[model samples]
Target: MSDPVTFALTVLALLLGAAVLTALFSGAKALTSVAHVPLVIACGLSALLAIFLVSKVAGADTPQFVSAPVTWFAAGKFAANFTIAVDPLSAMMLAMITFIATFIAVFSSGYMRGEHGEPDAGYVRYFAVMSLFVFCMCGLVLANNFLLLVGFWEGVGLCSYLLVGYYYDKPSAAAAARKAFLVTRLGDTGFLLGIMLLWKLGGWHTDLTALFDHIAKNPPPTEQITAACLLLFCGAVGKSAQFPLYVWLPDAMEGPTPVSALIHAATMVTAGVYLVARCAPLFALAPDAQAVVAWAGGITALLAAFIALAQTDLKRVLAYSTVSQLGFMFLALGTLGAVSPVFAVVAAMFHLFTHAFFKALLFLASGSVMHAMGNVIDMRRFGGLRTVMPTTHLTFLCGAAALAGLPLLSGFWSKDLVLESLQFGAHSGHPHAGSFYLLMLVAMLTAGLTAFYTFRAYFLTFWGPTVVPEEAGHHAHESPSVMTVPLIVLAAGALFVGIVAEPFTHWFSGFVGRTPSIGLAAKLAGAAEVAHHFNWGIAGVSTLLAVGGVALAYMAYGAGGPERVPVPLAGVFALSRNKLYVDEVYEGAFVKPAEWLAVMARVFDLLLDSVSRVIAAVPRLVGVAVRPIQNGLVQFYALSMALGLAVFLSFVVFRAGR
Candidate 1:
């Protein structure tokens, strides 16, 4: 096996083994106490392997490395196989995911084990499921074919369902799990159909390389390509939590905070963005699909930011922030039609890589706060934690700064790439340039909103006078070294990962651009838009917006602006606070109607069952009516026989006379 292949399989084995072993020993506290050891090792090994593969690929003659596929099944021209292929894009994802997961595992050990170092209930089960989720996610990223990808894709979703409902006894947790599963599956259906369409259109090849080759050789109609691409985007929309399908994500905070970090940052949500980036060839050919991507992402970004402005729950604020940030990624992707496919893919992926670090940091930081506060996360319930938990307060501030796109931070670099991409798209001479321009404006507005909400949450949680809720007694303090250490490491990532990657040098862009599919996408796009690597104007505008937002947030929350809303703006506050009633709209538009249909179907089924019962009674009624004739009496039988014989003789005489 090649290096990438060996590393991929080994990582999978380690995680799978850990999951099984931890599960078998869940009842044994002694055994379960050490479960996180294997997880940390496995995740850490994956991170190292990913970095190694990325470096090798960057210097290799080929853009990717693929191992010999092991065929699972075959019939004539169709076959499904297990294959591992690593490219710049997947490698980047691997590095980000596993890196964050390693820290998360370390943090979880401290988290699941109480602050006093005693193992909490279900500690072993938690690690077991967490390992399984990482395994599934790695498989999804390493998959070489659509068939294999979809398998791991569903596996990731299944693991997400389990993780989100970790507290199965809690009704909210269970319901949230179901909602996440069902909603994502709705998009997965479209994704599957799209895959099948592509298979048919691309000469029955499920291997991504072969499929792309076939499509390039014998191009499908533009409309067919567009339809397939759009269908695939449906899965992205749901998994990434955009618009109508986004309801599940906020509710998913009912799970453990670590689970939220994994789902929202590294694993489940990122899958959708990965899918779209992986299939750039198809989307590049479909301008209409690209436009749709851009529009959906822009609208989602703006809407989620607005909603974030009014949220009170600590994790819910970050949850909406994740939704909004994902919108930014999609917005970058939507610029595909207006710029080089390589440029757009790199821009979106760069953000994904950077986002994993800070988002995970913020969530884990929230976990730290929850630990200190006896699990009280509502900002309304707790205040003034800066002096109480100094370490957590400082690390959380780093994450918040990055998330707000402060200059020289991780988010600053990546978000500028996204905005720069959109700006290029606006003037790329494409027919949809006008629409792209509009999207860029929306994105600019969203940037300010992002900064505002992020800082607002920060100030509300940590800057006010000390007011710890009753849940947290006088003993509230910083998390232990096991937890805070990871926070510090991740805080470093949030602060420097982008600068180290060197956005100005175009190193990240060049490395990810070597991806074969990205090259193919560029060919399909034709006459690539020539855009600058750094645009000071766009950067300045975005920086100003971010700064302005931060200032506004400081004035509103930190500098003692009115605690209560102004009467004139109360209605707007209500709307934003209520998430613009999106859930209610969905209930009225889709849920209520489906529920009514279900009720009618149940009534119809009962009616049919009644009719069947009446028909079934006929045989019983006939048997009852003939009961007298069936009486077993010897004399009665003889009389009946004599009467029958006399009747027969009369009938015979009458026939003879006739």
Candidate 2:
């Protein structure tokens, strides 16, 4: 009902509707350069809407939900409503979705320039779907109730499937799309169950406010609460691409780079973090549930980080890195719920913000490289690119520094808060504190792994000798300004976020809480470790690990001095290049098992047929057996019928007769 909500929702509707209209009319322009105008305008407007919400109302109170119940279904004294809301959380997410969509839109202006062809149908289609994806994500985040959220979630998931397979003609893209959708569905099923369980809790309370109120009044059975948490986490694990559910993401690079950047890096994956943070109050009441969520999140983070250590493909490495960072956000939320619920939520939100910028920058920078280098992502095949693509190289370097948590980078500040959240966990009740300690240790291990892989990626792609393939010889150059502009903007964001993170943390603290303990320990630990060990502790260790990884790559590839790639590191390079066969393990464990099940489906069908055939024979056999009794004994049958009728009537009439 407020101005911000009305403006935001109206703009979203206008964007979507305008896009559809433009797409229809676009066919008349022979689908020329002008087709992009509508899309760019919509994206810009969307950004304006988001900024208005963020600047004017993100810190403001939640708006009362306004709904006109469109009858989705009516059955047996119940009706399903297509309800919507503009709460504080939804407003935040709405702003984020639109903002990222705008950046990606601007980047696409250059990245997808030559992609347009005769008829331009495909390009037009791309814009349409992209707009829908934004719409669905915004709608999902703003839904006041579970039913609406589920609908919106499914829409976003489907849009992701479409976007990931944007180059549908490519076998790789198609495969990746299928893989992503199927795996995510595994989690969505649980998400659906969680919704159902919530709906049924205390007699069909599906509205978020109503559900929370009921939970406050009559806390759910522990088993039900645990199941709800796990189910919701099923969606989280799949969306965030954590551990066993993570394989589809790296392969998703088969899509266009911008597609990968938008869906995997900037937007979709962070939905899980938003979900957990939104429900912090409910999770706070269930410590065991929180523990499960925290443990799963922590384990997932460590697994992905270790795997990232071995990757060689530039985008693939970043893909896994996204998964790992998301896991850290989850870990923070899951652990800090009871002790510092607000801090956990704020930290998670902040991490989500910083990660979006850096990760998207990383992907776009890689796109610039691929654009110049004949679509090659094999970092071992590149060298001395700083001279060739200065703008891109330098911008990417800044992005990497952010990702590696280097000082004064957005990643450093956000990542520090996440780490400190674990320490907060450690000082809770003794049992909780002990659990948090182990979790923090694992998270720290992930930090080391993060540095190792990020640097490995940087070194192979940027440093080392000039080993450009013959076809790629002397063709590399700076990308057009359109792409670099977004990269520079994002890089600046990444740099500035860290320096001002304290104030931002303070601002978000009003919604969550300012984390005094995390800041204390973070500063203390860094200073202490630096004083005790290297002149630089966390930063020093991280930089050294990164440099060491680069050095290792150099020895293994290059033959030239000071710029040598690794020749000896070739064989052992499989450790990093093959991602340590972790993807293979995932295929064997989950993928292969699913395949095996599919293979046995025919046998299962045959067994089912056998049972069905026997069931069919039973009815016939019973009918035949009874048919003999109905033969020509009519008088006898009539006598029996009369006797039965008399008894039946007597029993029925007894009370009336009396």
Candidate 3:
């Protein structure tokens, strides 16, 4: 009986209200102490509401009424509206985001507590910002118009800045926050310009559904369309941390692990994937743009996977893994010219859904490891923790296996779809079929890299002799129930969600394909028919790659071997370990130049200030010369007047003589 719009709004209200209330009482110790309680409740209800909305949309034969348009503002030809809209795509995002956030909130209750089981100083602030993040992400997916979506996009960015810098006193955390903000803004700038271009091309319609209809009715030039879509994707490149823009995500680990889990898995980073998928109609018209996306994603996947292989920091490995997995999603999306846009988007989103679970599990599990190791995440610092932290080890194993794309797990099912999409693209007889084939090869290689690094981190941390780091003292133990329970729940999702949303039945694809924009795009492109079936051969190949990588990892590290570089491969290992010098390149190439410019600007400012001071000195000199006449003393004033009269008489006599 609940209206989709109302339910969506209610969920947003609950989260936003939680943020407001918590912030209002942040000074009250009693209230601040239990901030996570309100967050859990709000997020729990949000999950329920999201579920209701998803079911309602999934069951509807036609597009359900999500919102009634209300104009918020109007310019000469463009307008922005305050409207909520939900298609199957947004509904699925809503369900996944809210559910994952609920459990994360529960985990934070224990994770944010100080070492003595007391609420930390920023406990309230953390929950408040977290609540705001969920609210922004929900708004982003549900907004009916591009302008509204962009607003929420930046809102989430702000929330990330706050949460990532929760430990503001630490230089690293503060720098990470700034890096995340500034780097993503680089993409956001492109995104905003792309939207403006779209608006102009589509008769100035800002509403998504309307804009798509307008563009289709009167298609713009192919070159313009390509430019707009590519520009928009530039935003995705920045926000999603693709290739050249991916440096900030690894450093983002400077924040609390819970925040890292939320941003990397469930919220901020996923926004880019969601944005691209949301605009599938626009992308379908731009094959060149799609090819760029495919190439960029492919390179990013392989690049990040390679870097992850040599990382000793457990969270950093996972961070690079997150980047690689995101590349897989982009790769699926990039198959537009060779595959149905609807199919491509559905495949991409399916991976997004499945990846969220295990990635969150991996991150939270790492947090558990950090907890037991006295906050040290370095793999070489301690080993053989299988017995010391049994529950953590088990949960982390589940997550690692899932991330490695082991058969029958969530990752396996979704990864198979990604590979299948690429395979289909390569043979689709499109002009770019050869390029698609090349990307498929890169993707397969990346898969092996993914599996290798994931389990490499796993084995190094949990499979060695029970060596506890000095940081852990002698009391290393499993995390508290509050944390482990979420792990169990998330681990279950990571293990089974793919099957539950199985592709064979077209359950996941059908639900997402029902998204109105996707349907509109398919109709516009004349590719309305769904043709993909599960490819056993693709599945077999991917499974082999995953298994091969895992085997290699076991041979290298499963026996608790010392971390060492082979003499011949030392050069390779060093390159990967140094993250291919991407950061160093940026430092020398971008950061240093920018820093020098800032220094130059500072010098310019000081010179201008000195010039102004010199100019002002003239006035001061004039004042000093006239000061004797203006003195407050009566005698000084009279003497000055008499002297002035004498000078006036002398001047008159001199003039007469002349």
Best by TM-score: 1
Residues 33-58, model 1: lDDT tens digits:
88788788888988888778777778
TM-score: which is higher, 2 or 3?
3
Please list the residue runs of candidate 3 whose C-alpha ends up more than 4 Å from where it truly belongs after superposition: 73-78, 528-530, 619-658
Error of 1 at 524 (Å): 1.2
The candidate 1 region of ten consecutive residues with least summed lDDT is 557-566
Candidates in order: C-alpha RMSD to true structure: 2.4, 8.5, 2.9
TM-score of each: 0.95, 0.82, 0.94
What is the C-alpha local distance difference test score of candidate 1?
0.88
356-402 in candidate 2: lDDT tens per residue? 88888899999988877777887766766777888887888888878
Task: Give, for candidate 3, the lowest lDDT window spanning 10 residues.
Answer: 523-532
Candidate 1 TM-score to native: 0.95
lDDT of 2: 0.71
